[model samples]
Target: MSKEKLFKVAFMNQGKVYELHAREVNQSGLFGFIEIGDFVFDESSGIVIDPSEERLRSEFEGVLSTFVPVHSIIRIDEVKKRGNNKISDLPEGANVTQFPSPIYTPGKGKND
Candidate 1:
């Protein structure tokens, strides 16, 4: 029997860090983006509920595929088993910085 493959992806979004598991993670044809699909979430096992995880589930509900900017990706790992998927606030004093978008001026020369 063959085991199913799973990947854990962590990335930054809206000043928060989102951690999720997916069956597919690949570099997208769209420049500077990574494609993720088949999001995995923990089923309700007991009465214990995590609001943060619920929010993550709701946010990804009905999402077929997501394209995340390469710069926003924190890490990707191939794991033997899936873990609790959740979203978290960026840790205090974290060294990671978000990538800045380039500024453009209409009809302005490159040297201007």
Candidate 2:
């Protein structure tokens, strides 16, 4: 995928901007409108927050109170990046070989 690829999803709860990939967004039991910048996971705690009404109230001021299923997402985009090579173009066959690097050898007869 291209690095520039991004999605402009609407945050059903809060109006914030977060550029992300469709794959990165985890959609499971979600139900209403998916907010753009809202996160399903807690950043600091690194915990998955349940998208429920009660959970939303305790965490983000009723934000994400409505479950927006992943299916609700509409806008999706492609990212652009360099060196995007196909798997078939990669070198294969018996010609492949590994080379030793001089960086591994250190002074005083020591190997780094």
- Judge candidate 1 against the unseen true structure and give its global Cα lDDT, from 0 to 1: 0.89
Residue-by-residue lDDT tens digits, candidate 1, 11-112: 999888899999999899987799999998888687999888899889989999999998889999999898988888877998777967743446668776
Against the true structure, candidate 2 reaches a TM-score of: 0.21
RMSD to true structure for each model, in Å:
4.2, 19.5
Could you give me the TM-score of model 1 versus the true structure? 0.83
Model 2 C-alpha lDDT per residue in residues 1-112, reported as the tens digit of each score:
6653333233212222222322233333433334333333323443654334234335444353334434333344443321211111113444432232332344775562
Q: Residue 76, candidate 2: how far off, in angstroms? A: 2.3
Worst 10 residues of 1 by lDDT: 99-108
Per-residue lDDT for 80 in model 1? Answer: 88
* Local distance difference test scores for all models: 0.89, 0.33
* Clashes per candidate, residues 3 or more apart or on different chains: 0, 16
